[model samples]
Target: MERKKRHPQGSGPTFDQLSAFIAQLEAKGQNLDNPWLMTKILSKFTEDIQRQVLEEKVPSDDTRWNLRQQMHCLDMVLTQEEKIELQLPKRSEIKTLESSKKEYGKTKDIRNVKFCFYSDEKDHWSTHCPVFKDPKKNSQHLKNTNRCVGCGFRSHTLAECKSKGCQRCGKKHHTSTCFEAEASDFDRTKVKSDDARKKTASAGHNVVDGDEEDDPEAQESSTENSEENHTVLTAKHSATKRENQEGSNIFLLSGTLRTKHPHSDEFVQLTVLLDTGADRSFIEATLVHDLELPQQGSVLMKLCTFGNQKTTVKCMKTRLSIWDICGKQHDLNPYAYKDLTQGNVQGVLDIKDLMYINEKKIRLSSSAHGYIEPHQPRVIIGCDQLWQFIKFDEPQFTLPSGLLLIPTIIGYMVSGRKFQNGDIPELLDIHDTSLA
Candidate 1:
């Protein structure tokens, strides 16, 4: 009966455990090294591992491997596959939090909401304010105060704002402050607008139904982008090229991550960028090859660049164990790509901003990132596993210069735009990605 047992499903027994079991059977006077015994051992593997091993025809080959050789191959494949299986995120683990409608209803009356931005009273609406009555002054006020022209908040910009757009021009700005047309013609133009214009207005007004504040991590990048003063990079596959542009403040959260060496106990460290925008994590193929990381499987993925260009590529999947800020190890299974990004735009912060952060005793993951030469990140941790690394209890701080410092399991991640006296800085914040 014991000889008929099989490896359990899910994360099955380790290679050492199976080897010890076989050794125990041999100690009991069983001739387990024979072909028949080898076949039985192969059958004992979990369903998935068995199927993988059989795919290469090890058992059916004309010149079959001996029992020891068969065991070695099976063990090798089993180790790689099981590691990936264990690291893969479960469906339940990634589910978004339930809506906060009930919570909102309970606290709606006493929410202490601020309806106006310009007034010190905060009780009256901005429309009632004397200064907001002037369209030109209202527009200038929004820009100078770094407020969203649509929602009139400092949290997000007009381009990124999710609130309702202007009712007059259908643009992402307040209707009262719209300079596109006079107030007398507003009603006539809005009603007679083309279908495309109406569609744009409808799309701009559509907001996510549920409470967005429930996921603060998702809001971090948006807040950083809105506060920063930088230009947008719209070129296709621009990350592969070298960026020698001066005055560009390309800020992406990057730090050194560690994984255990496959052949030894020592840890291997590699620089990785944390991106909340990407749905799935990615690793550079060259780094995987250099590290001798065993490939578990392959995935066919269509990668869409910043300029809306799409390319389908086959990505190899592998498991990695990375250590966080508190020295806790996390297992991640990431898809491997030929390349991710090569541009490293330094000079992110000026002297005054640095001094302010230092005075506040703020922690940063990679303060010297600006001083370093161009480097391609070996890994990019996307939204799929990004929340696992974020530290929610620790409050995030925004510098007077508009850069946000976010706390993570790895360390503090610096984000946002920096301004210099030269020409406008063109930055690449690769956010539009979908995994099909």
Candidate 2:
């Protein structure tokens, strides 16, 4: 047998293979003590194991002693290796791998097929529809075609459609066609009406008194009413907007990293959000359970959220091994959370969708943008451990639209906010949290 045919050091030919080879040589009437026969059998043993056998003290008279003792030594080494492998940390679990396969199968089904809401066609998805490129034209087409503004279907109208409404207005209309300014104005008007009703109820006697004109309180009330009327009109009809715009978009940094399986050579892919503002790193508890990770004891953590709300919870820590863009491995121990944010970092992206990135020849960690799954990240690499995973030597790319592409150990992360088709929803208020 060729030398290359021998298995590697950690996993060599099985004991059965060695036994069969020896039996074959014995049947040929070859001398079991022949040095050539012994050498051939030894070749099948891994290089490391062979070396160990050579160090054995065999009486010079017993040449076949090493060959006969090989099986017992090999078995001992294999068992020890198995124990060590079990002690090592693994990235992916068998259950996760199986579920991923099922998810992939589901993604291939007819329901997951791409379709354009604008043209009601399968040639493209709604995000890439030609009609959707222009808000006015898309809305006009939906109206002209008698399609539901909420879900782009002809079977129902906007009011009757059961699909989720615009995230901006919470109205029965698509986000692409939502007018946030209108919603804000309406809300302000309702609040003003409620205030006026309350004032009328509390000061009913003052309004009926003609003698109140001489009273300073009555005069002040009249002046306030006039100013309020002027303010309402200015808000409704003024072309100029307020100092802080009602709607603003915010994008958090996120990317995908490769993780190695502890027992096997296979690597697992994980999507993670890089939060420099966060004090502690976190991983989803469900994922930790699924991966069957080893916990290094528990910590009593004090979690603080928006409005200074604080809660005490028990947190478990587990080791993680992730590969960077250059295939450098990083080991980390992050606390576990029952859940993370529901928001996703970016929408489905493809190379064709981002021609600018291609024009600039920007290198990315992920090989294919189309294959980057659009799912909420389960891992958050907080500031406490963020520097260890960042590549300070690499250059950062800033797009014309204010979107920033940052180079980190894991990948080139796409971050910073961008207005989607001039549709800016309400500004998101992110509260910094403290973890102990």
Superposition TM-score, candidate 2 onto the true structure: 0.39
TM-scores, all models, native as reference: 0.41, 0.39
Name the regions of candidate 1 deviating beyond 4 angstroms: 1-245, 306-310, 345-348, 367-374, 419-436
Give the per-residue lDDT digits (tens) of candidate 2, residues 204-299: 322111111143443444443331111100000011133124332344677677876666868877778777656567788987876767887655
Worst 10 residues of 1 by lDDT: 228-237
**Index of the highest-TM-score prediction:** 1
Can you write out model 1's per-residue Cα lDDT over 1-436, one digit (the tens) per residue? 1211236644445556777887787789876657676677676677766777767654476456566666777767766765776698765554423232323323223225646677645777665575567778888888888888786767666777665677756877776577754556666656655543555355332211111123343344344333211111111112422233344455666666777776786867677777654656778888787777777766544454435554445567788888876788888878788757645523356666678777877666654333223345678887678788778999898766667787877767676665444646554443433332
- Model 2 residue 77 distance off true place after TM-score fit, in angstroms: 76
